[model samples]
Target: MDERSALGLLAGWVDAAGDDAAVIDGLVITTDMLHARTDFPGGTTRYTAGWRSIGASLSDVAAMGGTATAAVAAYGAPAFDAEEIAAFVDGANDVCDLTGAAYVGGDLDDHDEFTVAGTVVGRVDDPVFRHGAAPGDAVYVTGTLGRTGAAIREFERGNVERGNELFRFEPRVATGRRLAGVASAMMDSSDGLARSLHQLAAASDCGFAVEWDRLPVDRAVDAVADDDAARRELSTFFGEDFELVFTGPRAAVESTRGALGAPITRIGRVTDDGVLADGDPLPDRGYSH
Candidate 1:
């Protein structure tokens, strides 16, 4: 069978989860990054996905509760000669340089699609796994959700307030750095909150009790879709969120919240009840691109 394609663009991040730094050491590579970059700035969008690849992988690093220290990205080209490939590398290099990460090295993979592969190296004093959540740990998130996916939906629907907030993802580097061991379990939620929570619960062998009413929504998104159905659609399965969802003891959670000096609403708590809302059960689903 041809190499299987996944359901969503964000699925790559989920697949790269789990700890084995030694195994992933220098070999963690991505073919999609090069493909996206080579087509951009000259494609229909007229902008390469090189930077986007950086942001996406960086977000993955944050989700793993680590900060990217360096990255090695390579490109595959069929038509463009060495010069064009060099420009692509330079462009990607700029992203790494700006983020204080080094461009180490990587090889090229030539194929039908112009491909880009980015292998990132990160460091964490304490690796944040998907599990480790205790029964009473509270669920919290940094920043709001759904704006990026909502923008995509709006763009596809023939309207274009197209917010680049999610597309040009700003990795929560500092946030991840600070949250290292603060939360018993930490993850950057590229998928919707529902999905991340569900995954975390399953991994930690617990459930999430959420309060849907307190969800932090972006007004830019809420403005166009004010109805309940639209709001739910935007907030629920809308993917590419890239927000941080971490859990910890109530006291530790409260302390970390105060120290972060940012807004983190306690959307729920982990329990054995299996992701509840008040006393009722909730659907633990992730977002799709």
Candidate 2:
């Protein structure tokens, strides 16, 4: 079974297993694990790896509409290099600081390959959930899409520096908190926009009719794909952009415009059933871990 299937099995017994993060007594908590071979591409620095790993868990906190407070990581590798470890911690600290959080340090050990498990803690008064979307709610996405797709393309084309630079995504901790007041349902697009829409549809017992032309695709996607079809494919299915996908009342958009530092684009509206993009069915495919 894949990760989602495994989580399905666990959800049978775990009440808090369904959401992006577990919330208890106003505290939001989540954990994530990554491997070098599968998660980190070749030429990825130890620093980037650290930031990406911890940033992932923080993204979960963001999905729950929480203010990230602290984070920690357990690092494992077959061999230890002093310089690499220091750089990893530095990256971790930088990412946490960017989100107004702290990197409180973690454990390290030898392993068969480079691996990192990250955990983040946060606080929320009224957290947004994935299953709260209403039929008339407007669907929105924070920032742009296809950033990771462009980065992967650059990596394949030997533009290692630019690719690595693209990999350093900032977790939307503050954005999520701001959206909490307006968002009825929310999630992170780690598994790509198409898959994220499908998941939200399933959770909220609704459907989405997304406009192909409305997606705020990243400018970097143009360097990878010039045609419209290819650009849409990359932006929707490539995943790992770490942007927040949410739903709220149509009127809520104007209230959040001046407050959110990032751009929020309305791409669609919640429907009675069936996920569709530009009038055609959109497949639930994306980055599977």
Backbone collisions counted per model: 12, 0
Q: If scored against the real structure, what TM-score would every candidate get?
A: 0.75, 0.97
The lDDT per prediction is 0.62, 0.91
TM-score of 1: 0.75
Looking at model 1, residue 203 earns an lDDT score of 71
User: How much is 199 displaced in model 1, in angstroms?
Assistant: 0.6
Q: On a 0 to 100 scale, what is the lDDT of residue 109 in model 1?
A: 65
- Give the alpha carbon lDDT tens digit for every residue of 108-222 in model 1: 7666666666667776656667778888888888877776656665555555325433344455656766776778887767667767777788678888888878778766567
Off by over 4 Å in 2: none
lDDT of 2 by residue, 61-150 (tens): 999999999999999998889999999999899899889999999999899999999999999898999998989999999999998899
Best by lDDT: 2
RMSD of 2: 1.1
Could you tell me the TM-score of candidate 2?
A: 0.97
Q: How accurate is candidate 1 locally (lDDT)?
A: 0.62
